[model samples]
Target: MTSPASSKRPLWIVAATLLLGAAALWGGSRLVWSAQQRDGGVRGMLLETQTGAQHSGALVPLAVLAVAGVAGAVATGGWPRRVLGVVLAVAGLWACWIAVDGVSFSGFPPGAPVWQMFLGRALTLLAGILVLLGGLIATKRAGAMPRLGARYAAPSVKKTARDPDTELWEALSEGEDPTDSA
Candidate 1:
């Protein structure tokens, strides 16, 4: 028999991982990933900058999915949770790929701030890994997670009112005179 604490551990892990992953994704998206110098024919050299969001549109969606995964873990169980977990995992994998690709296509110029580019990519990668871990665990142990409003679940058994007619027929069948009481 699995203890409640043991079962709840996965839920905690899932919540933490999902929340952290989403944070990373959202943070990375806001960072400047790449910069470039543009030659102005009539003017001067103009610098251009690109961000993680500008690189790929998937970052925000992946982040949102991670957040939603946390909620789904809390609110759902059984097959629905499993499906959500699988989707979260897939989104994380996709984010990882996108992060790598964005960095590869950066085309950093000489003396470019490579740190920013790598940092953003690293954060995105970390987010993906965290979400992936959470998703896998959620899929495997969804039943153990707490459901929404679990504390207020209705009782499994309830007392129903006895019918007078049924009682009378039962007494008669048992050869007891229903009208006899001294």
Candidate 2:
């Protein structure tokens, strides 16, 4: 007996989840997290901003993990997908830790919107959560997941009902024509 869920694997959802997480991580890298006044320049004349990647080296790795996970999930199934899931979960946790523990308030000058400085970390945290979600799904449902090109697999050849060499020879010896049996 098979249910709908068992027969169907929503690969698109998994793919979308991974893609969203990756996009968020990449976006986090581009967001300005900290700003500082330029050295040797007029006061407040120029401000240099640091993005998530500049703030912490961990973000890049997390992003890379998400990217790789997408490919792995699409290309693999069963135990391999489960292992990828574990990796994504661990990487997500590490990213969350980096975002929360790596906070520094020293870069922004006075009168700057202090709350805005956390934008990058927020993005990182969100990305981590999304990746973790995708990982958990992959881990728990990997057995049912389908690998790429599974639908295009070749059909197996079927066996003939009777062996011509064995059955035909036997029938001939018995004075029964094999062609008549067919």
Q: Assess each prediction's global lDDT (C-alpha) against the native.
A: 0.85, 0.76
* lDDT tens digits by residue: candidate 1, 1-182: 88878878899999999999999998889887788889988887876778889988889988998998988999988899999999989988887887777356546776666888888889999999999999999999887777778766654654343898877776775578999986
Pairs with backbone N, CA or C atoms under 3 Å apart (clashes), candidate 1: none
Best by lDDT: 1
lDDT string for model 2 (1-182, tens) is 66656645555566777778888888887777777766655563566677778888778778877888888988998898999988888877777776677578675675554566677778788888888888888888887777887766653653343766986775565578789735
Model 2 stretches astray by more than 4 angstroms: 1-10, 36-48, 104-108, 111-115, 152-182
* Lowest-sum lDDT 10-residue window in model 1: 152-161
What's the distance in Å from true for residue 54, model 1? 0.7
lDDT of 2 at 143: 76
Q: How many clashes in candidate 1?
A: 0
Clash count for candidate 2 is: 0
